[model samples]
Target chain A: MATQRILDFLATRRPDGPCLVLDLDVVRDNYNAFEKALPNSKIYYAVKANPAPEILRLLAQLGSCFDTASVAEVEMAMNAGATPHRISYGNTIKKERDIARAYELGIRLFAVDCVEEVEKIARVAPGAQVFCRVLTDGEGAEWPLSRKFGCVPAMAVDVLRHAKALGLDAYGVSFHVGSQQTDLVAWDRALADAKAVFSALAQEGITLRMVNMGGGFPTRYLKDVPTAQAYGQAIFDALSKHFGNCIPETIIEPGRGMVGNAGVIKSEVVLISRKADNDNVRWVYLDIGKFGGLAETMDEAIRYPIVTPRDGDAAEPCVLAGPTCDSADVLYEKAPYPLPLSLTIGDEVLIEGTGAYTTTYSAVAFNGFEPLRSYVI
Target chain B: MATQRILDFLATRRPDGPCLVLDLDVVRDNYNAFEKALPNSKIYYAVKANPAPEILRLLAQLGSCFDTASVAEVEMAMNAGATPHRISYGNTIKKERDIARAYELGIRLFAVDCVEEVEKIARVAPGAQVFCRVLTDGEGAEWPLSRKFGCVPAMAVDVLRHAKALGLDAYGVSFHVGSQQTDLVAWDRALADAKAVFSALAQEGITLRMVNMGGGFPTRYLKDVPTAQAYGQAIFDALSKHFGNCIPETIIEPGRGMVGNAGVIKSEVVLISRKADNDNVRWVYLDIGKFGGLAETMDEAIRYPIVTPRDGDAAEPCVLAGPTCDSADVLYEKAPYPLPLSLTIGDEVLIEGTGAYTTTYSAVAFNGFEPLRSYVI
Candidate 1:
């Protein structure tokens, strides 16, 4: 749920423009809930999802390990009071300079999928605790992860062995089931793949112990996703089934699930005119769109639950768009949303489950729109 | 064609990261050429296309008015030494505050599609020169832009009437044939639509004066486009055919066509590894991707002419991707681009015709990566 009381409170106070509201209290509760469910698992919060300073500060205070994809994220983790030991450079495709800089900033843990990246890490951060990201089919996921990352299981074993030869810590394997992954079986399948890689590395006499299950845990959006407890149980079952209950020091990187529900975006409806007299598609133009903060609306891959203030009025299917002059700034064009017919100019359109990818994906200066602003309570 | 000598010079000088290089001299040439072709048409350079200070400054020096989409763009135009009277607030969806601010900053002309925006503008910018943006089919464009703007021609007349009633200048009719429109027939069709609106508005005694044929002029990309002179001739012939010799004062908003060819992005080939032994698809990772600067590759909409070092080797079809850890960051996963098999890490990939919409569309902190850097030569 969006916690209507908080949203109502926020709308009354802030009226300048579109902004994301983040609640640290909700963050703390979500963190504790995840921690309680998976007691043995280390929570490495992915910084790329929502790297708000206050959010990172709260997570850092919660003894959260950081999963950083870039040098700036590593530095952000450190600046948020996380020691280098708590930050893992999880990006496989990184420049050698970024790798070296992360190492200089005291980050020792890195993730790599290829032989070349392993060599770069070895050259930059020798003896770094590096893990091989193994490939999975990314089946039954909304945002499929089969492309753009990971190596095949057979190649992953060699990458790990090569890591050991290059004076690097050949830590365990990692895999992602893609972002907002709907299917629970995907985790089990990925865990099994991780186990296969682990077994292959063990056969080579290279004892790897760290298993980083990369971020895929879905957050509550337009649809009700499987809860954190369900994910936790599935993860636990997968770990037990794969490792025979002798689980490695398991790491779960939760980016969206940790902060997604805790935030809401408040945007005003700029125009709510039907595109044409005969046209049924009412174009509801909002101040924010793809270039503003809703980049995940690409093909409607991630649907943020939207709510208007005028709820009692009859609803009509409306195509929503952002304020930018670009034709591509439309949010929901194909899918005509049933918005309240009473919703008009200046009416609040609160977007829920928008914390994670919203703020970080905005195109700065796109059509002269300011960067997406976020406020924490 | 790209100035290869300048590109070679840039690659030799800048080896730090991916950069979009803007040639101000080229911008000046393109501007002069367009003005020479369409001597009577007022050129309002769309600031959203590039918004580089140097580029804006050069255009401003060449006596170009700016078509501003947002408050920041209006301010950018002002900062570039453009008078407020010279800046037309072209974005239909805008905050009331932004309208007031623009009015306060002395912006007189504004674009509107619906009644709500017209009313809002009348309230904030009373007696402002308001243009009615009438809708068209937006046909035959490379990047089709039917959604997010304009109203029916019938609604446009009412909108203009309403604007006049509210003490505003009901100025004109505008229709975009979308960006990078391939067919010249789209313009003729849109011009006919504008003529209809013009006749309708003239009968209503609104006397709309400007025919704002919104931007659709294509720039050179991977494929060759019709010359600007060809577009100017078509536009002139269309105006003569519709409005006759006594046509109203015209305004053309050229965003991409004006600045796109003046820029090129030089990005380093980060990594290239065969995805699988049997799979012929090689994954070529670049320092820049969709989020970094190439957001137009959403569905491979904008194909830049990519040139790499070590040409003439055996060509292999490779899938290009950005450096982000996100799996969705694959740039050309579906479109397997043929590149030199000898291409390796740190090799330069010079992307031509990337000047417009490149630097302005970058996500600021996407995965902790730096914003797309742009250098003006």
Candidate 2:
């Protein structure tokens, strides 16, 4: 995709203020790359990343399933032509009305993480196919999911037994290592626990048809982070070895890994001020804030690269802030300040790797700022 | 305000989800305290904190000035019955159209931080009353506003001189020490710098009419922080001593100090899971995320207390997490686990100190979650 095309498109359409640009070419390439790494498994595009109806429609055209966590997400997928059987309502905290709505809408593949949730689903959607979420022992993982919603392996087996007693179909097992997970060994450990749970359920005359390796595939942000292909292959090999024949189907929900770097939040440099404590270090304020694309990185103590429209060699370090009055409106700190380009007040700065949570999860209509505008390359 | 009455009102009126319950009684008390402490200064309620129309109406009733940072904020204040002359368009990086709109709407007071901004405002709001924002030399302040929008003290005088030449009224000097500023000595140093700027301007035969001191009054969140009264009194004393009889009319803009603790974000507990590494620890998940009530505390590395509906003996520490898929959704780590007394599946938890930025700034409609419902007491 031509960068100038997007720039020109935005300049023509959303010339009033800042806008987020999504690159469909990069998104399709990311989806194909992940599919290539896990050739045998089904790729459930996590619509929580960028739930633009057009993006979801494109993924559906590419033969991708969806992992929806809410009724709204489910409806979004359905609107994009995703069949109920092809979607998984994977969130554990199932609202009673939402569960009833999903069941009425024919969404049967529900993910449950606790005994109480299993009972709730059994009461609401007795015919639903449940995926018992198992807790992984992520002792050294970067982002551990077991701390919040999943049940223990033994408890998961009990949940499966409860589902059997309630005459509900318990057909699969799932585990999320965590979001932005950096360690491949954590996948290996989670797979081992999943296989153990599968065998234990089999001993009780319950056969599992699918094993869902929940999405935590890391997206490339910093140069040192591992690529998506590297992480996908590691999980694919582990699933192949552990649950080779027992599980005929596998589903992977890759949200950020597939779309995080495919979009950029383009904003204008509104103000620049030199720091009084350090004259060399200046602060650049953009026309956006924590309410905009930087919402995901808020308080995460992480930094994203800020690139100016023009390139130069005289780079310095500067703190990047947003236009909001709140003190927490900073976008990046101590970022490598771009060199003096042939740009002035209205020049744009493209903040990359914001595709995942930038638009679908964080943009608000506060201060009358315009919502994100998208384009297909 | 009666907490029980407010709770009952919200239970009936608030939408079925995570929402904010704003109490105007507490806000009135806060406003009066700040007004009493700075008896001589004109108080401007920063609308960026909680810009709900009801909040603005209450502040207007209290005879406070309106400090608007955007055109929408200015419109909100005006819609709440504030005269344009009582409103100050105080943002440093403003669009040309917004400036033009403010000028057309008859807003007189404006803040200018740089030479470019002065030129822009001159072209847009030539009849506006302008104040050159000076960067203070006081380091170690809690929230430094100079890092993003203000000019150095020496350069500020030059900008003021230019503002006078551009056929605009260079009214006086203004400086923001920072948000949630706790250091009294920093205010002393900033006041001293402002006095020096005042003397230099006076020598040039510029009789200033207003010395606007930007807001940084600390709100009560953690116990160790000083009260708003202490900070307000210190500022008043510093300004009176430095300028003596030649003091210009004092102006202050308080955002969080007036409304930070005046509201509570009430959410229901959906799911709970114990940590794998520590058997004694558990994690309680709420429907809100970092995108909701916890937006202000982002990256601050601070924890807020969570109060259960039915108080009980504190159990072991449990981490509180949000419904977002990100691992950074953890709201409080090692929070004293309030015993789940009478707290079954759908019990409510009150998260406080969310009145400031919770709704106006961070409540994104993610996962189909609508913005919060507001009720004034």
How many pairs of residues collide in each model? 0, 1
Pick by lDDT: which candidate is best?
A: 1
Fnat score for model 2: 0.30
Clashing pairs in 1: none
In angstroms, give how far residue A65 of model 2 lies from its true place: 1.6
Candidate 1 per-residue lDDT over residues B37-149, each given as its tens digit: 78889999989999989988999999999999988999999999999989999988888888999999999999999888898998889999999887778778889886678
Which lDDT tens digits does candidate 1 get at residues A1-377? Answer: 56765666685786578888888888898899889878888999999999999999999999999999888899899899999999999988888888989889889999888888998988889889999888878777777775678888888888899999988989889998888887888889998989898898898799989888888888888778888888889989999999996799889899888998888898888777765667877888898999988998888777788888887789988888888888888788777778888786888878988888889898887987888988877
- Candidate 2: the clashing residue pairs are A299-B299
**Lowest lDDT block of 10, candidate 1 chain A:** A1-10
What are the TM-scores, per candidate, against the unseen true structure? 0.97, 0.89
Model 2 has a DockQ score of 0.37
Chain A vs. true chain A, TM-score per candidate? Answer: 0.97, 0.89
Question: Model 2: chain B TM-score vs. truth?
Answer: 0.90
- Model 2 score (lDDT): 0.74
